[model samples]
Target: MRRGGRERSMGFFEHLDEMRGTLIKSAIVFAIFAALIGYFMKEFNEVLLWPLHYVQAEKPTLVLELGTTTVMEGFNVVIQMCFLGGFILAAPFILFFVGQFVAPALTDHELRMVLPLVFMAGLLFLIGASFSFFLLVPSTIRVSIEINELLGYTLRWTPGSYYSLLTWLVLGVGAAFEFPLLIVLLVYMGVITTAFLRKYRRHAIVVIFIIAAVVTPTPDPVTQTLFAAPLYILFELAVFAGARVEKKRNERLRAP
Candidate 1:
């Protein structure tokens, strides 16, 4: 159905059609960005591979001479990195399409929150990816290498594997960092109250620790804490954001 079909709700086929249209538009936008970014794959590869290079040069921990076991591995890594770069760069527009799809169903308060959230969402993703690249991924790799050494196995890691791991870790952390927006959205929609967040603060902290452990890939407490710290802070920020919006919503409700 169309955006404002109130009298007659959307049938299944109509919903499917709208979803298909949204997917097509999203794909077109992604393709354009991917093609442009793919042209600059070299620069993108350097950035993505920084953690590996840094660990190798600085620590001299392991002879992680990144190799290509397959004839096409080099070309494949370039393609993969290009698409990953394109996705990271194109995230904002992708979010815009998402916003467009959801805007019609939003209340005034939610509509107002959308722009800031969109911007924040992108910024948060970058921060998260940076965190993973600069610290978490490197530390995890170092620890893994140490373990392999202890087990008396030499690591002949391939380029494809390295970039694959990097892409997933960076993107995973980035996507995980969007949790505050979820919290704020819930508040804007009156789904949950500030009191609930406050009441479950301890439980939230425990869950955050678990998430940190899962995301960091390193077993050490320090590395886990590094991941957990920002997450806890983000959760607190979510609480404050939600509270502030809920207060505004309450004030507007009492307005003349």
Candidate 2:
């Protein structure tokens, strides 16, 4: 009995230590990537501008202008973009570390389900990011630029502002895309049922559009459509995925 009690005490400390170590390591890795990205800010900035380069190249005065009143203003903006770029690049690693640290206590079946969930979440995020970069980004920038021309306003975009808009939209949409995966996983774990999802379907549609409007970077209707349409489709996909999970759960319950 004493041995069992002592082991339990030690196990608690061990878990705490493990969690601390994981957190520290994750932070360190993020910092390292941030520094590296900072060092290569110009190169990454070019990557961010590639879409703009292609779409707006016809306009000679299309430049992202930064107001530099401080000695280090340029450096500060570059460093900021680099940090965001690094975070984007390191997202998978961060997610993996989180999974490693938190998921071991789950059952084997849970682990199996969760691995695929992680993979699907990552894939969906990538798709969302791509959508933002290729379609939404170009479309919004084009519209904004054209609107400036139509309103007879000279628009000078700053690099910091532009990249902030870009990164936020990309990451935000990517995170949003994981909603379906979350719903599916919840159903698979038997935490939520398909019936509940179906019952709340209309309410979810209203909420989904609200979320889409908030999450999308541009307030324009076209960009909102680009963001919300995919989200609605993903919600439908989640319903289907939830049904599969429900089917599996019912099968297990019916097993001898």
Candidate 3:
């Protein structure tokens, strides 16, 4: 029995080593994907610009300005877009790789909970990203254009700056959308209870607004409200989900 216990302990270390190998493999895959994205930057840049282009329905051409100071600066913009595109494109695979790696350490019940949560997180993130791209970006753009026109300034945006801002906003929203998933996972792990979440609802509202303030690039309160409101709603949803999960767990325990 002592020998068996020692072997089990060694197996635990072996599992850790396997997890390390999985992470290393995932990193290598990401590097290769990044390289491929770098090679096809123009195509990716065009795709990224589509949201902006579609929004400017009246304008035949959207002009972006850059300093003629150095030709290399232009190439740098492409590289930036490539990296952004690569990360977005590789997100699903990255999640899958991470899931597969950690899944071995989780119990079957935990695995069932985690897999669904992972997929839901991915979906929610994409929805938030699309919302930012389709709604928030265009609104911000129109506001900027109107403000610039009033100031007698031409809308001379740099491609590098433009893509950077757009990508940042989209990714930020996407990451923010995972708030519910995180909360639910915490509840599942018993790190937090549904009652605790409910009790903190008021504080959460204030925190959500603060988060929104930090997230929004536009200084407008409207944009901040838009982001914050949805996040708060998601928080409520998470609380309800946790309550259900907790109730189900209690019922199982009480059963024969």
Candidate No. with top lDDT: 1
Candidate 1: C-alpha lDDT: 0.81
lDDT of 3 at 203: 91
Error of 2 at 229 (Å): 2.1
- The residue-by-residue lDDT of candidate 1 on 168-191, one tens digit each, is 778878888989899888987899
Predicted candidate 2 versus true structure: per-residue lDDT over 1-256, tens digit per residue: 1221322234778889988988887787888888887777678668888767866776777764445555876776777776776677777888888888767666667677878988898899999999888887887788788888899887767666677778787888888998998888788778988889889989988888898789775678888877888898999899998998899889999999
RMSD (Cα, Å) of model 1: 4.1
What is the per-residue lDDT of model 3 for residues 1-256, given as tens digits with 9 covering 90 to 100?
Answer: 2131322334668778877887887777777788887777667667777667765774556454434345676777767766676677777888898887666556677777789988898899998999888877776776676677789786667766677779788999889998888887787677999989888889999999998888888778887887888898889998999888878877878899
**Comparing 1 and 2 by lDDT, which wins?**
1
lDDT at position 191, candidate 3? 90
Query: What lDDT score goes with residue 82 in model 1?
Result: 64
Give RMSD to native, each candidate.
Answer: 4.1, 3.9, 3.9
TM-score to native of every candidate shown: 0.80, 0.83, 0.81
Model 2, stretches more than 4 Å misplaced?
1-10, 58-72, 189-192, 195-203
Question: What is the lDDT for 67 in model 1?
Answer: 86
